[model samples]
Target: MAYVIDGDKCDAKITWLPVSGSLKTGELVELIQLVEEDDKLSREALALKDIFNDIIEEGLTYPQLGYHDESRFKSYYLSHAAFALRLANSGKVIGGFYIKPNFPGRCSHICNAGFIVDMAWRGKGAGRFMAEQYKLLAPELGYRASMFNLVFVSNQGSIHLWESLGFKKIGVVPQAGNLKGIGYQDALQFYFSFVKE
Candidate 1:
C-alpha cells in the first residue's frame, strides 16, 4: 500500500519510510568496498583497471562521485564534511547515500548527494525515502541547495521523482556521459533548493 513519509514531522508530503540513519564511519569503508565490487551497483567501477585506477579510464559517463581515490573520498568522510546514510530495518542496512558540502568556502551552503539501493531492493521506494530525508536533512546540516551534478538523462525514474520533489533542471553537458554500447550521452544537471524551516 502507498504511505506518506515527510522530511520531518512538518512538511507533510507522503511516500514511504523503509529505512533511516546516519551511516557510521566504519560503514563508509564497507560502502566503498561495495561500490568497487564487480557487480551491478558497481557500474562506477567498470572502467577501473584496478582498485586504484585512473579516473580518466572510467570515462565521463561513470558516476565517479563516490569512487574517488582513497585519500580524497576518505578525507571528505573523515573530515566530517561528507556523510553517508544507510537504509536499515531491524538492524540491517538495505540501501545507502553519500552527501557533502559541494564547496569549501562561500559555496558551502550548497551540498551534493548521491544514492544507491540494493538491487534486490529496487522498485520498492527506497530511493524516494532517502530523497525525502535529504530534503529535510540538508537544511539541518546547513545546506541551502542540494545539487545532482551528473544525472544520466536516461534515468527517467530519478528525473521524474526529483521533479516531483521540486528540483529543477539547471543545465546539461552535451555528450558528457559515456554509455556502454551506446557511446556518449548528455548528462543532465539538477538542483534542489532546501530552505530553512
Candidate 2:
C-alpha cells in the first residue's frame, strides 16, 4: 500500500510560480502546478496516465505492478501537491510529480515525492528539470526536508540525479523490489534537507 498523509497535519497551501526552460532536445517546456479545479486536469491526467502506465510496465522505476485507473491515479498522484511539465508551444503534458508528507503528525515536515517522465522525453533533461523544480517547490510547501523511500538501485539515472542534486543516500533495503525479469533488487533511500542545521 502507498503511504497516506493525514489531511489535518499537512495543511500547507500548495502553489508555485510556473517556470519555463528549454530541454536538451531543444523543446521549450513550462512547469505548472495542477489543481483539481483546473480545466486541463482531465486532459493532462489522460496523457499522464499513459506515461505512468508505461513506466510501471517497464518495472524499473515505480513499484506499482498493474496499470493505474483514473481513480487510483488521482488518489496516488493528485492527493496532494501535483505538477506537470508541458510543452510551451503545444501544451502537451510530458511529465509530472506529486509531493506529500512521508509520514503524519511530527514527521509531516519531511516530504516524499514521486516523478514520471514520458518515455519519449527521457534522457532529454526533463527529469533534471523536474528535480530542480521539486527542490524549490517542496520547501515552499513548508517541507523542511525531502525523502525518496524506494528508489531502485538499478535506476542509474535517478540515482545520479538525486546525488547530483545533493540528496544523500541514507540507507538501502536489500531485496526491496521484486522487479520484472530482474527478480528482487535493492532499493535506496535518499534524503535532502532544506533547512541547514
Candidate 3:
C-alpha cells in the first residue's frame, strides 16, 4: 500500500491524519507497552525501548518519569505538522511520523522526520505509506528538505523504502547502531529536498 502524494500511489485502504496534539499519555503508555512487549517487531525497537521509554514518559509530564531523556521530545518533532496514519475504513492508528527542524536557526529549513509502524501493521505497507505522506506534507509545513539522521544499516526494508521514495543516501557513520539481530552496524543518513510543485 502507498500514500497518494502527487505521483506516489498505494492500494491500501488507509488515510493520513494530521497530528493535532501530542499522543495522549494513556495512548502513549499503551504504545510503549506494545513497543516493549511485542516480539514480532524489529529488534532495534525492543532494545531501544530502554532509552526510548524514558524520553517519552518524561514528556508524559504533567507526570515525570524522572531522569528521562527529554532530548527526543523536541517541540518541533511533536508539532501539529506531524501525522498519524489510520485505516480509511476504520480509524486505527497503524503508524505515524514526526517532523522537526534538523538544525536550529540557519539550517531550520531542512527538516528531520521519523516513522514508526505499529507492530500489527509492520509488514502491511504502513511505513512506506507514511513516508510518501510526509514528503507531500513537508513542504506544506515550511520545510524545503527532509532528512532521516540515523537509519540503521540492518533495516534493509526501511533503507529500500526511503530510497524508493526519492531520498538519497547522504552518508554513513560506521558501527553507529547496535541492532539486536545485526549487532553493531553502520548507521545511514538520508536526505530529500522537495521540488516545489
lDDT value for model 2: 0.87
Candidate 1, poorest ten consecutive residues by summed lDDT: 1-10
Q: How many backbone clashes can be found in candidate 1?
A: 4
Candidate 1 wrongly placed segments (more than 4 Å): 1-62, 65-90
Residue-level lDDT tens digits of model 1 in 36-155: 322232332322222223332444334454445645543332223222233332333444455566655667677777565544455666667667777866676567898887877867
TM-score top scorer: 2
TM-score of each: 0.60, 0.93, 0.61
How many backbone clashes are present in model 3? 1
State which candidate, 2 or 3, has the greater TM-score.
2
lDDT of each: 0.53, 0.87, 0.53
What is the C-alpha lDDT profile of model 3 across 51-143, one tens digit per residue? 334334433101123342323332222332444555543455556556666766667778777666655556666666556667776776677
Better of 1 and 3 by lDDT: 3
Residue-level lDDT of model 2, residues 26-68, one tens digit each, is 9999998776664334787778888999999999878888988
Error of 1 at 123 (Å): 1.1
Better of 2 and 3 by lDDT: 2
lDDT of 1 at 137: 61
| Runs with alpha carbons beyond 4 Å of true place in candidate 3 | 1-80
